[model samples]
Target chain A: MTQNLDLTDIQGNIVKAYGSSGFFKARYLFLRVDDGDKGRDFVGAITSKVTSANEKLKGDDALTVTTNMAFTYAGLQALELPTASLVGFPSDFVMGMSKRKDILGDDGPSDPKYWDKIWQEKVHIWISINGKTSDVVEERYQWILQQIKATGGVTLLRGHCGEDGNGNAVDDLPYQDASVLYEKDGVTPTAKEHFGYTDGIGDPVFDGQTNNAARVIGRGKLTRSGDWVPLATGEFILGHVDEAMEYPQTAPRPDLLSNNGTYMVYRKLHENVGTFNKFLDEQSKDYPGGKELLAAKFSGRWRDNGAPLVHTPDNESKAEWDKKFAAADDATQKRMLTDFTYNEDISGAKCPFSAHTRRINPRGSLEYGVKDAFHTPGALVDRRRILRRGLPYGKVKDETSDKGNHGIIFMALNADIKRQFEFVQQQWINYANDFKQGNDKEVLLGNHSSKDPGKVVLQVEPGSGKPPHFVNNIPRLVETRGGDYFFIPSIGALKLIAGGLVDPT
Target chain B: MSNIAGKAYAMNVITPIPWYKVWLNRLIFWAALKIPNVLNGLLTLSLIHYARWVIIPRDKFPRLDPSQPKEDLNYSYMLFFSNFNGSWDQYVDSFTFAIPSGLDLFWKMNVKYPKSVPLTPFHNYIQHNQIDTAHYYNAYPMAASNDVKSAKNVKKALIDFNAASSNKSPDEFLEDYNKLLNQLQNDFGEMRPTPIVSLAAQAVKERVMEEQRQSH
Candidate 1:
């Protein structure tokens, strides 16, 4: 029998509560079992026992279990269980959604004028389980892999950062698997993405019932704390949502949201360190200690405040930054510089829209409630989040190194890859007029591949009635390489993969 | 018994115990518990001493201890070292109050001699100089001297040595020196924490002078 419990006791929620500030690092692993019978057996054994090992494994108290199933070529079926599905989601899931609404759109072109300025595309990865290879499976695998490598792991082309360890640009270095590891926690399997920023944060939080607030009663409705309910397994895994069937997204299925089925996307994007430094140097020439200013602008906080927009380089001292309220004293002036929120300032004057900080999280005015906020199409955000798991691949090279290489391996966990992550990349940052308000794109991470020299304007002051200064010198920080989608099976699937397939004996 | 064909075989065989393996397992088990405790205890004590002596004293106002010797020999056991006053304290804290002549010897050992050399002052400074200024002259001249009684020759020798060591001309040396001095003046003159160290020293000096005054 199934037991009902608050999400607070779940493994992911517990981790989030404790992980508030200290080094926020996490790794994600994805695997495709060779044999279904063995995989199912392996997965089942671990899931049945994993709950007791939560504390030892640094997971939350909640033991997660779900089964996502899909069809392979020639009617062969498969199943997966994502880490996000097993882990209780963090509050940031909702916060990130609200912020995403600010920059994205539900339909059509977002910023029409800049449409020609930048291009946003996705790469996908498809791997064929081998030795026992099927032609249909191989065809799908090559197609997806090629796509990912070509796009930047959005589809599946192999992409590595331009520079290599010896400092020479491997003009021909093909994108490949960044890194792989052995057994996790002795029995579990896992994988790491590039770029080291816990990729799993991309996963979304879901409310179990169809009606989002049906589970919560009266007073708890609007509160952020009240929103902390365990997401339904269907939100992340495919067949887990609807136990009876499979192929939820296909034409023959009853509903688009499948049971225990999740679409995952992985990518490896290279950050141009040399280009980044040049941009910082050029931008900060006018300011004293301009490098620091650049650092503040990119990080969104002085090394201390840890909040990107709330703090700036000029007001780096502790006393100056701890301004929760306006002060009249000499100490107050220093504190006033970083005392406001993004709600108070929508313009990219203080924090550039395309900056890594802004791209990672642009809160406030961009949320759902604000005017001009983009409406995310189709699936409500509750079912559309992804878990990002990637790491830095290749040796970090210095400017003098002739080898151009190094980049992040990016991964995301979502019920629908096309609707969630890919949608965000294409419709929000890359698609002009997707928001229908202005031609503004997140200039930093946004792709400006066109010849017109990708242009983005930033308002230096909020509501100052002055025109935003257009700065065009910013270069690409990340480039897509290659990656693939893999199903992390439930204990049942692990048993199937480890044990003999169809153990009729 | 039976002595037929292959009969006379031993029925039971005796085997020796693996005593060392047993002992190793026991040692590991005991060490697992004891080693951690010992290491933790050491760490705790070091932290406690650091907090009690360094952080706490600095946080709470510390009074200048003139009567106390400059060096606290117990400092070797401490985890926290005073960034600046540690070496100075090592000298002044070892001062001898019983002998007046010890003051002259103290200056000669700590001030005139470099840190690498052994610090043994002359046995009899009284015979060398009765007046304080005479002692200063005797010590300073020699400390600055390659050979005694030739200040002019010493200056010439220093200039020659500097030129021999450097690949650049004298003009380049002066230019570089002046540039470095300018930079140092700009950076250290305003930003240096030297004033804090000097203030600490002055506070100690005042306490010593006050004691001397009271005695007088």
Candidate 2:
């Protein structure tokens, strides 16, 4: 009942999460097509540069620099894709993220008006270049600039004309940079985001997505008999049957045009570090376990490392748990980071019900009350799983200021946006009653306004004899600055769009 | 507060149906009830616990009190209610996907009803007409609809196994128990409490525990 994913068909970044591949520096640019023929020529020129899943990465032909391209609905239209092919695309992708704001809860301060000035006008194409070093990233970006220059039809879409410290206009290249956070030595990437958490743990392992067969244990679906099985490849990739064992009705046709394609949700989330720290400082006062425990309660993961609260259980144990992590072997360390479930702590004593990670993944915890309720505990969540394809954009220069340009470039890859991505945002992150929290939002992404007066419960085991602390006045953690949905087409589809071979008739 | 009981949440939606289409809608429901196979796609969706549709004709609006004004409506109203597991999005999206034609046939005649395609408009249509449940009750708060049905099979298997094992030797009884386990492997697990039903509930439990500790 499983089909081996055609690795050669998938786009490079879709298969390989760039950070782990030692590509720390990334440059992102959007290009708009002014002339159709030149746009097609531009696509044709970049076709060879676009990395594929089967590209040789480890040896002499090593991928020192990686490039990938995706298109907005407007971009596809600009490329002059046929009407039939265009109409077959999913409604969410066609509507773009800004138009779907109501469904996405992108209201209040996170509205489209607050987006990056570049997003004021919709752009046609999105281009990303990832590299091992700054020189490589810049070189690739410059080469792309050449392509835009050479093709008279294409032009770089610029962002806010904000001044650099020297009083010179910045974003002149009309690009954004996202790099992995580095340790103080600044030589090695720590894979930590601005918040000082060891991020990117527990990415889903679909069948045939990677060579790491062992990843299935913690990353894959847990079956009725307690066996770990990889999820259907179709959950993340198009042209295949998803968890529902049915091809989505919206998969674009002239089948080759949509096959191996997936939707990417690009969001610029602004992290209010100062507000977060101040809130922690304020709330940790007169608290039993202090700020560390409160921080753990927010995400269900220890901020020092990515250790789940399930393993630590309490403040003392968590402190000790962090120490053992570094000394452990690769296998043990990976297990410590990714493995474990919320079933044992059924009351959310260890991991609060509204914890950010729990709200996002839930990881079969939603069915914890009754074991074997479904053949697989994660049946409900399996379909909603999304591949997080994002990186932290800006550096944290000042830790004390809530006002700064520092946050995550949160991109999500999914087969169905409305079903998987939108559902998670609307049903889990924005709303309550799903996790039995009664309108209380997830702590980190709660978008808490003063009127709502962000309040939440942090519980300890009843056996510990501590009353659940009701934390009050939680502040907004993240706000959306800009983003839209883009379609990462297969190489085959790219060729079709480039050749003007996509036919609806 | 009462709409949710453990895994199931009750949803109620009432929308006006055109007078001309009311009978046709009723006929569709009657056909679905009589010919169960027509609902094969819906039954396959698996999340729905129970669903029913009722039509109240414009003239049928009840008038009980003299003080209450008699109803004179141009359109009959159709009421749809269901108890289902998971979030509202999953329930509706699954319904739309599982049985697009069936959903259209059921909701096709309602006033300003959008067809169940290009999802947002359809979602808006339902949300516009939906009414929150004031009170809802479920006998098995800890179990899903499937759990309740499986429990029945488990009970029957246990009764038969108990009767057959009465006269067996120790080894034979062990063998009989293994056979019983094999027959009901899926029904072996018991339902436990889901993490923190509500913060209010957790607060109450914590306060009671604190008081007990103080008294002790």
Candidate 3:
């Protein structure tokens, strides 16, 4: 009988939905192992153990990392199904993401730039084992950590190596690793990139072994007592049961049920904040405080999740905000959002047509005309969900710095990439033409809003069905430096990674 | 088996049965093993990318939207979406939510009909098309006991029906609906309203057209 292990149950502690402060920003590292045989042998030995543990733990079942390994055993293939077709040989610098240190500089004792050094980031261990045995992989993995401890602290940086147009060995410089946690007075806002906007306002709730009854009230309660159903925990945190269900191949053992989570995909996405700001400043000449208008166009809400649909400059009242923003029962919220045809807010009266929130979540309006509209089924929304983890990398240098490299290491997890992150980016962010009423893309990171090379709108005009109006703030705020997929195994899998295979022991 | 393991002698040996089947088996094994290896190697390369020539190290990373309120979040995105519930039944049995209790008798006929058979007579359709609700309920081993009971009732009723009798033809099923309408009309007598089936049929017809256009 074929045994395929599912790895979706394992939850990442810090989900991106809830806002992050510090200590939790994502960092990335990429590397490439030399020999396919050694790497494959290494991976197979390690992955089987990890996935098996995940099978026990009920973790994420994506072969994001292993499929790219040098050699994959047929047995392992039987376990994991390939979603994305492999294109070519693996590169030397395979990448991984992580959280930044207390500060964004190299601070180890030996090298003044130790924290930023490339070598320090790598988790290295020596393995002299072969075969497709899970034991060998686990042993070597454990030994590698021990080796890291034996050696004093070392910095590992990730970089790329390829031939240039002239066939020259083009090796990009190693990135200086550092976290945004130590930025004094500067708040590392737990926000999605570019627009300086808050995201993941509402997410599905999940109920597992933990007593999360407090989180469920009103319409939040879907299933009865001990009835398995989906729940929304929060953003940037682990998601709900329906979300988790997408990743498994079979039922997970009860012992591995609690808190076991999945691996995260991390990438550094660069934002052209300066260029975006300049464009918005140039276009919105008619609006009073055009920059703020620009911010409104892209963000949909004025920095505080407050929508412009309800509040005008003359009528920006707290009572109005409160009246419009009441978090009612889930069914009410669902009805209010779903039953609408045009953008829920007509005339862009409350939220603009092109706000980031509406672009990513569009809650009700996107599915308005479709069949089975009321059922916000998993198939419809799973593609919209992304496991966003990562943090702001690099510094402003000086506040007056002309250009800087800063961006988010965006991460996502889903059973089908076509349905989840890709669809959201292609269909929603880039192609979504309708908003609360109609028309316009998110001004910040969306394609429609960024159409004009020169104009950057912080907020697009309401119901205009045009690109976001430009705004000025920072330029090139983030950039897509690089990215890669990975599969994090359960504790059992980790043990397999640490233990070398045994000959029928 | 013991003798085979004991003597590690010949690399190749001939079997009397057939060469083609042996060759086919070898081809299948090699293809299964080699293709995965090639794909795995290439996929690993995608991970080894760089931004400005720096290697990104692996470690614990963040997940989900980092800007929403805590109360709004139930669990992490990965946990919520991943296998946090620790079962594959949810995914496998996801399609079992509805099992033909409504007036739309011929719903989900595609699943019942195949290319070879084409279509079934209307009365016979109900028996062959009867949804085994118990089978659907049993699909999820972890489902609640109450759900299992209700699903069993639906299954028993479906299984007991004969294909040649009640649901033998499409026209017969429609006739049954008409009979029910007449009964309702007579029972109510005082007040009557138009049935919902015709409206559904119209809507479905339009949707099929739209689907055809989209496919092209």
Segments of candidate 2 deviating more than 4 angstroms: A160-173, A462-465, B1-80, B83-89, B92-216
- Which predicted model would earn the best TM-score? 2
Q: Is candidate 1 or candidate 3 better by TM-score?
A: 3
CAPRI-style docking class of model 3 based on DockQ: incorrect
Question: What tens-digit string does per-residue lDDT give for candidate 3 at A1-505?
Answer: 0112233433222222212322233213333333323433444443333322122212354221111111111111222222121111011112222221111111122122322223333333211111123343344445444433443232223443223346453444433222332324565444443445544333433333223433322112222132223333321122222332232211122223212333234444545556555555555565554465445545555554433433433234534554555766655433332222223343343454445655565543433334332223222333245555444444443333324554454555432233345445543453332221111234555432122321222332433433332233322233334443344333443333224221111
Error of 2 at B114 (Å): 23
Off by more than 4 A, model 3: A1-26, A35-157, A160-195, A199-204, A209-263, A288-290, A304-315, A318-348, A367-373, A376-379, A398-402, A433-441, A447-478, A497-505, B1-107, B110-216
**lDDT accuracy of residue A319 in candidate 2:** 71
Reference-based lDDT, residue A2, model 3? 19
TM-score of 2: 0.74
Candidate topping lDDT: 2
Residue A297 alpha-carbon offset, candidate 3, angstroms: 3.0
For candidate 2, lDDT tens digit of each residue in A1-505?
2567677778987876888878888878888888888998899888879989887666676889988999999999999998888999888899899987766767688889878888887688999898888899989988887887887688788883234556454644388778888889988688777776667787888877766656776688767666667887778888876765566555788889888988999888888898888888899896787788778788888887778988886778887887888789888888887777776577777888778888888777655566334435675677778888788877676788766577888888989898788878876786544464544677888767756556776655544434466678877778888889999999988998999899867
Q: Per-candidate TM-score, first chain only?
A: 0.52, 0.95, 0.54
TM value for model 3: 0.44
Candidate 3 or 2, higher lDDT: 2
Docking class of 2: incorrect
